[model samples]
Target: MRMKRYPFSNKALKAMIAATVAFTPIAAFGGGFHADQVEAAEQNLNFTDLESLVAYLQTVRKHLTDEDIQVLNEAQEKADRISAEDYVDRILKAPVSEEGRALFVATIDFITEVNLLEAKKEDIEAFAKEQSPNVEAVFESEGTSITMDQYLTYVANVEQKFLDIIQLTEIEDLSEEKHAIALTRALLSAKDPSENAVITKTILRNINQEEAPGAIKELVQKIDPNLSAAKVVVKALKKANEKPEEPTPPGNGGGGTPGPTPGDTTPTDDGVEVTPVVEANGNEVIGTIPDALIDEIVAVVTPEKDEVVINLPKVEVGQTVSLLIPAELIDKLKAKAPDADITVQGDGVSYEIEVEDVDTAALAKKLGVPVSELSLKVSVNPVPSARALEVTKAVQAKGAKVLSQIVDFSVEAVGGDKSVILRNVGNEYVKRGFGLNANVNTNRATGVRVNDDNTFSAVPTRFVTEDDKQKAVVKSLRSSVYTVIEGNVTFPDVDKGNNWAENYIESLASKYIISGKTNGKYGPDEYMTRAQFAVLLTRALGLPGADYDGRFKDVKGDEWFNVEGALMAAVKNGVVAGKKNGTFAPNDRITRAEATAMIGRALNLSFVDFDKEKFNKNKKITDFKDAKKVGASTREDVLRAYQAGIVAGTTKGNFEPTAFTKRDQMARILAEFLIKADLMSELK
Candidate 1:
């Protein structure tokens, strides 16, 4: 059962599935019946021949169900019995000679071939050989030889034929599988599980009456364990009286057990929690569904705290939304989710949810965690004269190639160089960022930016270049995650250069290292905390296979102190083979000297070529003296990783060995470790 590989290939995994599937039977009837029998019954429903029937049935599998399946079995049994009975009854009634039975089989063969035909025939007799009857014998005996048409037509319509086949079987007839299948289909088509239990019982009754076939009864109970002899009788009565109808209950309908009497409750606008009592087995537990399936469903819907929520209108049938949430929320969200009609993401947090109504936003907000964060942007028709200079500078500073244009506006007041001031103000607005806005008014200098309830903000910067905001709407679509992540390293089409790595490293503050200052922006040059250094070192050494479960008292899921422990684990794993303090100084701005020492430690070098005083401690890592020392001292380790093509300098092929490593630098360093170790290589 165990494979030698750590991660089995797809082909090997499929072989495993196949090997296991041979022994996994369909346990619909408490393992009383084989899967092939049910499958055969399912197969017989659409057969012209065995091959075509199997092929076609597979395609229509989504449409096939327990009721149709049951009916097929019933009809098949009835057909076989009637066929035998008609054959015997006609022979007994007529007292035909031996030659007549052979002739009758030939006629039946002719009819079967004609039915398999691709062409229409006006007279079946044209294709069939008419057997000239025993004229003299016919006069003496009261027997008749019928045509193929008459035989086929009569066989299809007769009732008594159904009884004969039931008598000929040795093994118990598994009409139960068909019954289970058909009724399950009915519930499925109705798109409700509320009626699933009832339908299951009704199927049991139609097949078994006395002592009730244990197999059928077991299947019925498997679906609705509360179903018993009394309940089965009541359901049989209901089935006999009522025509089959699709289940369409309002509160979690179709598949669950049908509610008492008029089986629907109306939805309300008011916020009253509607609790449902789903019964499984004979017990009335607080909630419904088996433990295994419930856990599986919950595992799919747990949600996390930090993900974007898009404001949307309500939902309607056939509408779907791709809502993204954090990985942590999968369980809690699934617990409150509707059981019927909605199809959500398999990942649970970022799932594509199908809503019956467009007003689903209201429901989602109520059922899911509340919105936690918001981002804002402002737009204006044109940059005011005072803001133009700042706008220009921002435009220049943008690391991408951009088409540029400017407008000069005369400002009458404020400074001697009024126009210049207006331009500078516009530049400042660009430094902030903007979009085109139709409602921006040039006449007014002051406008409200933030709304009172913290509901909305106006992005008030603009360009006269974008005279119409609609014109700014681009036709291009954003690329997928695979593409965007690729751009984090690749030189962009705009020739922004490999400088993207710097921006990527800079952006890592949010996901890679630590929290920012109160100003809501990372102080990129500020000294990293000791805890931050541990994290950086961990990243530099390449995050190794972590057995650390965040189980320690100081390393609970949200604890900030986990960083040091995580690094310590990395150290133990030979990922970071260094240590400074028995306790790490979690809040110090590390100097260039310290960074080199740490990198050296990670390389597991017994000695550095020069003394500690060889390179200046205060200089940035970008300094050449430090770079030379690092490039020369740990040459072998650096060469090992570098020649393996895992290590490289930031710019101009120079390893800025003396520069103070920033947050981004830490990530690059760690990425090299990962690449060299042949671990988490995708990070490269």
Candidate 2:
């Protein structure tokens, strides 16, 4: 029997396909399949399918033989012969070629699309009933029989299968159009709109378009009119439709007709003549920016005392501007503009105030300063876009604190961007997003800094808050904020009693083993270097004496007094080994696994006994989710330390063994090790 092939109508296909993930092809008779062929095909076709499906489709796009199709069909028939309970399993287990994978995805997608159609319940029931006879007859031919209820269940679960396929496929290889279409369809068909909306938005934001185009717009329109999806679609479509074009191309171009001549002047409503700023190309004046389109932004910083005053560079309202000021300037700004809109950001906190109707003269008099002196510091202010404001809000949501010595604030237009960086530091593999829209360009940076916007560094285009990505950003930001921490518990900048490890830190500090930086701040979240870690360990262990004989090339003269003695002691005790280059990189941050191993060595030196057998038997360490990722050599040490209650994993079930230990973390671990090793009492 020739299998039935139901092709969608041409009109429906055209409306549905912006990019397609629908093809089931066997090994092509000839031609090599290009890796990029699938994505390019997505630009013209409709949406849907998984990896085997993607690979199969890629092969089909390359070539296929009639014999390959026959073999694929026969394999499918054989797989279908299994019981309904065994259907999914058998299909997954069966060995098939690239064509077979495409067929699998296509079959699942077809059934899912049919089930999700918005027809009447009665029509759906009737359609299912009508299709049952044929479905069952085909199963019967394969010596397998399925009840009507089982068939309906299979139809209902087809959505899940499609989801599975999508999860398995290398979405990076799929075009933005294809991903957008698939996600949009999934959003529309989802039974729970609220839950599905999140997934759809996440996918859309990755491929986030400044404006929805053509089929995407239509797809968005198909969703419920009252949903935010519809509103977003309409807005995107409007943006696309309303995008403005430059008056004319710039430079010395000998192109078509030139715009208004260089000396040409137009009269304003007030009878004032204005000449457009145009670039000269021989006699032709090209690239005109009209006077009406020019906008301005000005910022004024005034201090009560006439010590230091600043008037920033003037910029257009939509242009991005960064303000660099001394940390002491914050109080002056507050006095000048109290009740101003303030947002605490990295490196500094910023306050914005409108410059509409403020009396500069009176304000100067009130502050006991002359108008001339006040004017030296203050300038006109520009308003930030709603999108920029939104970004500020998101940044603040993750715990933003002002920097110590300097403060910087920046604001720019929403769409006038150059590029962004999306660095994934999570343990699990993450699929790359569609990235920024076509308008933005991305360039990698050697180093990133806050408040520096001239070259793209830390700007994020797609932010997935409430996920590992957000936490990673927070962790990284916290680590980067401090290079030095010097203070006691009462120090204002120390952020006293903020974390659960406060007690541990305070205990260590009380013993004079831990001290803050010269700035009177304890940077708890700062990374702990090898030298720093060694000093802390020796101090905690109360190892005596200083012996320096140039054992390691990196450990130099008397200037290294702080860690030199501790380093020599640690080396003698077999706690640390220098790098392969015969250099002890004392400044290098210590990883979590390395720290644990060091602690285990110390415990052994101190004669602390814990059951190794019990540690190996404990499911908490042995059955960790990411246990396999731990280095084979250090895995047993980590498990033993964890079980002995000297250390713990980062999250509930997974030990991020390779992650670097922070200063605060080192203190906490030291405290825990002391308690577990019965040394806490001796310290007191």
Candidate 3:
């Protein structure tokens, strides 16, 4: 367990993902709204309630930091000293009057201030379902003159504003477009219109345009009683979009408005496709938000003074400590902290503090701050860990927040990127909806490399497995290549074979110019030794001296088995001989590491290692997309090979790093390489 130095959890970060957990109670952890939306809401002066709230929030924003008091003092002093009306004009947008603009600025400043009040939400105000009269009065600038119709229009506009936000405050609805309006109206309007037409349309049809035809067809068949020939499908569509509370004719019902005709080509701007409501009658909701009226949000002017600073009596001077050190002295400083019982946190220049007895003056002097600035109550606003800070920045950049309280710091450490960071949504109910369509589970992917528009592709596309031994895969590739060299390989048709890869290779033997043994067996499991592969390479290429090279330490007179064919095929042709170390280890299994080295040597490619330690070279070939490789004679050679794409992983995508090389696999890899290198066409 980590120590909780401050009163907050060590991992209580502002950027943790909001993933849903089992046994977790229902809650909305991932609210779409970002700090900016709240800021935007604060900036809108057209709406009264929003304006008032904005004023308060602005104040909060101003003082959000601990250094704010000093910063404000300096900025305000500068502002006071200048007192330029033109500068004030630049900051305010009130119509026609400078004083009005100043008042507007004041309102902004006030709202910004209110946002800082830790006591916010403590007032606990609610209007329940009934429409709040004040909401209209403020929007219209009339305490009692606005009509209900006018008030609703204002509600729509407010809803629009919230919808425009990347995210909004936590609300029960948001499942559909109409719900946006309902959600907005509900927030301000007390009346839940049972007949509200808007609610019906959004709830049933707004979000299902792509699948509407099928949904409509099903609805039509279920309510078959109402569809006896000649009715316009539009009428059916209208019926299907209806709300449940509204009465329908001789109903056998589920809620639906009317459906569309066969010739309909597109979805409505409202995001719904017209479909026939075939149920004896689909359900209908009766609700309409009349247009042409304006929405009004009222503001209650609260007169209050925010922060006020005053001249203070001179603080008794404190001792001073300076923090300037040369790099050469850092080691000496670092060496003293452990023995001195002092806590120094930052890197280099050892900045720390340890006081057995601190008088006020000594404390002031030690901190290098004036006594006047010190407070008996040292309130350090909550700060998340550095890992969480990265997450906060990422989430904030995307206009989102981390509302889930979780101890898993990895999500934040991954930087709140949806691909890499897992979210703890704090509630199982809400976790169901996340990522693009909320269909893909993000937890499985290692990470995502995102595009500028926030689109992402999974990194290292496949999962790593223990079976991913690079050596084994390399062996298999060699074996496959050997099989390709010897043709007439009769094998089960791959289209029906249990092991498709093996069967496919056998079928392609002739296509690769592979002439198999007279026995008709491809020796599918045969290990393709390096020399055997030379024969295959020689057959494919016309190279100088493609015959014999008695130059190898192991390829001696009595020992050369297929050396006649292999030596001519490999040595004369320069396919391969051995490594820089002089020992070919030819009989030894060929690992991806070795394969990479071989390919590097074959390709004469250069491989550099800037940070070899960070990359796990042992990583098996998992990504099939990698095909280019640099053939070299070193261990790094394998990495270059994997990176270049000359090699790939097995069925599970792991080039087993420590496994043996096999003949069939080698032949297969080379054959596959032929296709990749564009040297040979894909086997027909």
Candidate 4:
């Protein structure tokens, strides 16, 4: 008989089966067979689920002799003689009742069909390996002490109980209750069952009604009294009847007298007269307000303003004064000020604001250090018309001391649409290798944001040297507390002492501009292929490539470069061109000249003269000794790229245009291009 084809691919079907087997529990074997005796009799084939069984089979298949195969075949024939219903009845030690027989039979048929599918040995092995994590999760949830046989017994008992409940229920169509039960099952089986239990209970309490029907509720209580599916149905009904809250009247606070309006003048207890200034952009400015009167002004100011900017006298050095803006007022300051100037000013003293306390546990986890080893400080600066913020840490660490100082910089209205540049903030100890012992690679310092959930997320950061000082520059879009931490990415093969491109590689890797090989090595000296270079260039430019239509005959959709959309994006952006044969030799090694041409085109560097010959004749672009060796097609591109600081010649003043570009050389070129084009923020 021909096998029935599944809707999904063979690999997908195998994966689905693996996942189900990994999570499913088998029925316990009966007939006076002890667990140990059954295990020995089955030759360790008494697995809890199919995933473990398949894994064991694959492992032993490689070493199985002809005699062993014959023994296994004989055993399989005996197992096959038993019908699915009989096997279930024997393993479960209970016969399926009339009410649940149909469902049980349907499940058995599905399993039989899966067994009939032609799965190769390698396919089963791959599926086992892929689902190993899920299998481990199931065992972990069930507890390590519980053996496969014990788990099977427990599962069988649960199944029998569920079947009994089904036999007792008269309602044939309980679709709504079924959905609620499904949700409850998922929550109970989640990684954190206790936490999910609270969520389920809260949901039920808010939606449960005294007048709602109790039949489904009683059924659900029989399954799990702590969680009821009928509550969800009540929730749906209540939600459908819920009415929207009425909007508050303008200028009125719950039918009370209207509060202080914009432009209102209020006097503090200290007799410091404060006036609220409202701008055309809806920004409220309370100028010349003394620091002592901030609280009074905050209390009287209306919360409807876009943002409240309080101008005060210079804050004393080392004195931290928290802003007293009300929670409602802060909520109103949600509009992003992308174009607003944000700078650290006032000569060692600046306006300070209170932000959420740092999560030391999360920070320690991210930095891979003990909570006791970390210390954090938050600094707030509110400046007018400033586009950049520079918060300097002048404290120097002593010899051999772990410099785990985390400086948090906070700004308002810096939206994701625009990035704020922070300079000279976290590079004090980078040059001295202060964090080497603490697993902090100072050479690879990165920026991170403090998430609302008290977690840290990496932000794009780059390091640059200016005036003999190494500075860590970070760009962020959100107005929140941001800090610089030692980057966790490093390659065993790339060393800073000998490799000229180590900084470039580290910076790019930290920002996800490049990745290492499978062996955790950054093949810096290895030659780069055309497709590889194109992919790196696309990442450097941050281009979002469009859907490809097989523009290059030789580049297939399945190829990594095509799937990555590098070649397609390069072609779309006019940064690369195919050969005369109409094929992009993506796998071919890229020459320095070819790479230079691509970089020049990406930067949009062009001469006024359209003709290359005329442009070359008009300008002496380079003084390289081997300038003539450069191909005529790329000579102008090479010269233009050099002029734009995107590429450099050899030490001997020879442009090795025909040399195959190494991975290190490619990194340097891309880094230079990003810095020169101002695509990335660099400290001056």
- Against the hidden reference, what TM-scores do the models get? 0.25, 0.27, 0.24, 0.35
- Greater-lDDT candidate between 2 and 4: 4
* Cα distance off (Å), candidate 3, residue 104: 99
Q: For candidate 2, give the lDDT of residue 342.
A: 18
Ranking by TM-score: 4, 2, 1, 3
Residue 443 error, candidate 4, Å: 4.7
**Which residues of candidate 3, in runs, are more than 4 Å off?**
1-489, 492-498, 502-504, 515-518, 547-549, 557-565, 568-575, 579-586, 605-632, 650-654
Report the candidate with higher lDDT, 1 versus 2.
2
lDDT (10s digit) by residue, model 3, range 1-684: 632111000000000000000001001111111101111121122333433433343343442344544433443333233322332222212222332233223322222222222214332122111233432322232112433343333332332333222122222222222222222222222221323322221121112212322322232222221221102111222233334787656765777766522212122232112111111211211111111110100011011211111111111011111111111122222232211111111101111121111133433454455543322211001111222234333533432222211111111111111121112111110001001101111111112222233321111111112232100000010100000011133444222353435533653453333445556555556666655555455433322223334556665534453433544544532346576666555566556555445554444411111222433465543343333332233545555455556575668655555565665566566655444433343444
Quickly count the clashes in candidate 1: 82
Q: Number of the top candidate by TM-score?
A: 4
**What is the C-alpha lDDT profile of model 4 across 110-131, one tens digit per residue?**
3222222222446544544544
On a 0 to 100 scale, what is the lDDT of residue 41 in model 1? Answer: 11
* Full-model lDDT for every candidate: 0.27, 0.36, 0.28, 0.40
**If both were scored by TM-score, which would come out higher, candidate 1 or candidate 3?**
1
Provide the RMSD of all predictions against the true structure, rounded to 1 decimal. Answer: 29.5, 22.5, 31.4, 24.3
- Candidate 2, position 298, lDDT: 8
- In candidate 4, stretches whose alpha carbon ends up further than 4 angstroms from where it belongs are 1-486, 496-500, 605-619, 679-684
Assess candidate 3 and give its TM-score to the true structure: 0.24
Output candidate 4 Cα RMSD: 24.3
Query: What lDDT is obtained when candidate 3 is compared to the true structure?
Result: 0.28
Ten contiguous residues with the weakest lDDT in model 4? 32-41
lDDT of 3 at 173: 24
